[model samples]
Target chain A: MSEVLTYITEHAVQWGAVILLMLGLYIVMTRGNLIKKVIGLNIFQTAVFLLYISIGYVLDGAAPIVLEGAERYSNPLPHVLILTAIVVSVATTSLALALIVRIQEAYGSIEEDEILEHGET
Target chain B: MERLHVIVLVILLIALAVTLVRLRSLLAIAILTGVYSLIMAVVYTLLDAVDVAFTEAVVGAGITLTLMLAAISLTTRRETKPGKRKGQRIVGAATAIVAGVALIYATTDMPGLGIQDAPIHRHVAPYYIETGPTETGVPNIVTASLASYRGFDTLGEVTVIFTAGISVMALLWRWGKDDR
Candidate 1:
């Protein structure tokens, strides 16, 4: 019990991130709505960003702005990497939304099951 | 105290996720998703990832929400209720649980919360930290690494963004003949 408490206290943020990740996955898996799935995907992506940023964190560290006498800074590599990733995610979301629009126009329905049924009939 | 804040924000984020999944109204989902992104941006800021937080605020909260709303306007606001498939839902739940457990197991191997001597901090990070300011003359190590040391990668990313923009325009553009 003591060990468990120690672990939780040390890694609370990471555990929270993991829970968020699972929630996103659950949303993606259960929802039948196309737009909802996209939103789930966004959530999933954000959770990943959280995990990465958490990994790069340093206790009592400053942001990666190099001041004259700054001693410790959080890992800037992850920040740079996440910047590119964030932009890519936005691009992906835009493309996915555009495709959703086209799907609606093509089948007159945005539900995944409805689109499948329309194809069958 | 900061950890407590992170916990609270994460809990709120989970609540928002639950709400998003329960709500079938597309407009509400879009709006909630925007709020979710904003919260995520705040979380990023709290983690000392200000650059990422700024980008998330602009692109994730702002542009993505606009695009989702535009898509919603083009389609029905309510999702059609499909016949419930209990088997699929069960399978999905099982998969998510298994994946989540595996991820948690992996986290056990990760370097503990904020140890400066972690493997990630030991690699190219040290090199960048030591020389980035001198080589690039930029105070922000992230900007220096992103724009100078990794110029080619940034260029490639910019190209990808440009291509995505062009592709979206092409996909949505209506021909003059169709308009008439």
Candidate 2:
């Protein structure tokens, strides 16, 4: 039991990421609501972020700063990428929401099926 | 390794499954999806992708969710209830299974997680690791990759975003209330 616990502790980050990814995907796939889908998308993206960062992690590594006598360090590339990604995500989401608002103004409801049927008429 | 963390993960999975299975309200689902993103951000932090996690937390859990919610506000939420659709589920399931299989096959040769000797470390990473220290003087490898080696890709992405914005503006201007 102790050994298993140790394993789990050692691999906690990995496990957390996998579980989050699965959850996000499930939400994106199964949820019927548009907002929910967006939420799921966010979740999915977060999982990917986790995956990338987790890859950069090094046990017993120092910060990715070069020093006179420092040994190994964790990679900093993923962090930079993630920052840019965050900005992009924010811009896209805001744009999407604006479009959605226009759509809502033109239509009466926010449900996907109702909008489709309405469009047919 | 505490039992609590494992239990929490299992519970999160189950909640996600139920959200997928039982929910009928699209808005509810979207909101839940945001929750899911927040959880994933936490996971990303655990995975040591601190930058990725930060992005995810802000964009995925925050901005993306807001945008999706706005989109839903403009459209219908629920899918049309099934009346005579039969094979849709089968198709979906088949596709999912196939995708899963493909993914598993792809990962079979993946370098073991966190192994420094992986090809990623040897062939791809070393160049960035070496040049970045003295040349660019930037501590962030990601910055080096984007701004130097893959600068063209970054320019392309920026162009795409610009084009998208312009397109949206054109569409809106052409279809505004005054025109109608």
Candidate 3:
């Protein structure tokens, strides 16, 4: 109905976040390429950051600068949290990439199933 | 309206995700990931989290993308098909659907975007917004909260970054000889 469409349109950002999260999950679960898995994880992490940032938005608010005439501001806590999270995400990406490199060196491949087969033999 | 722009960006994000599913080239996927992060950063700015948008642009789009490119170079850019697992795709889709449904259900009662009465706007955020400048002498509430009120947490975050640096160095650095 029109009412449902209106609500969906209003919270489009939140819905976007959820759908992206699911896409990330699907990529991680189904992708066999190790680098692809990492990409999926990064997408998943970024979607979460979006979810938090969207929560902090305020109506007719400016940036969280405590200046005169800026009567209202969005939440700053999520910004702080996600700032740290972004660094952590890159850290995770780096570590995972290094591991992927090592796997490639050891097993001569980066595919999950190939690595598993190498382990069995 | 401004909301229209956000809708367009969200649509672009979904379109990129679907393309990622179809793309087999690792380098192409990595580049698309960077584009995705950059668009996500713009969306953050529109939502008023400029600090977050800035960091995401740097770390997510910049550093993370570079790292992925390096990783692709070190490994193969060609992605081979998976073994014939009959039900993996179905199971993955089912799992995604279940989790997506749960998240959607949880969101049903959440305050709509930018509503003042939301619980997030009710508690400590008010304290930060009201007293940030006076307490920390920083016009930016995010900087004030990041540096002063939550200084210890920021320190912890720095330590985490430092740890990550150390870890990456340890893992990737060749030390003296080329092991590979």
- In order of listing, the candidates' clash counts read 0, 22, 0
Give a tens-digit lDDT track for model 2, residues B13-84.
Answer: 446745655677767766776776677666555444555666667766776666666566556677545443
Residue A94, candidate 2: how far off, in angstroms? 6.3
- DockQ class, candidate 2: acceptable
Candidate 1 local Cα displacement, residue A10, angstroms: 2.5
Model 1 alpha-carbon miss at residue B69, Å = 0.8
Candidate 1: the clashing residue pairs are none
Better of 2 and 3 by DockQ: 3
Across A1-121, the per-residue lDDT of candidate 3 in tens digits comes to 9888768766888888999999999999998899999988887888899889889888788999876788888889999899888887887788899889988887999998888898999
TM-score of each: 0.95, 0.69, 0.96
Please state what fraction of the native interface contacts candidate 3 reproduces.
0.83
By TM-score, the better pick of 2 and 3 is 3
lDDT for position A32 in model 2: 41
Q: CA lDDT of B98 in candidate 1?
A: 91
Off by over 4 Å in 3: A1-5, B178-180
Give a tens-digit lDDT track for model 2, residues A1-121: 9967655554444555555555556555554444545555555555556556656665555545555666565666666666566666566655555565566667765446666888999
Q: Pairing residues by index, what is the TM-score of model 1?
A: 0.95
The digit string of per-residue lDDT tens for model 3 on B57-82 reads: 99889998898898889999989977
lDDT of 1: 0.86
TM-score evaluated only on chain B, model 3: 0.94
Once superposed on the true structure, which residue ranges of model 2 sit more than 4 Å away at CA? A1-56, A62-70, A75-121, B1-21, B77-80, B171-180
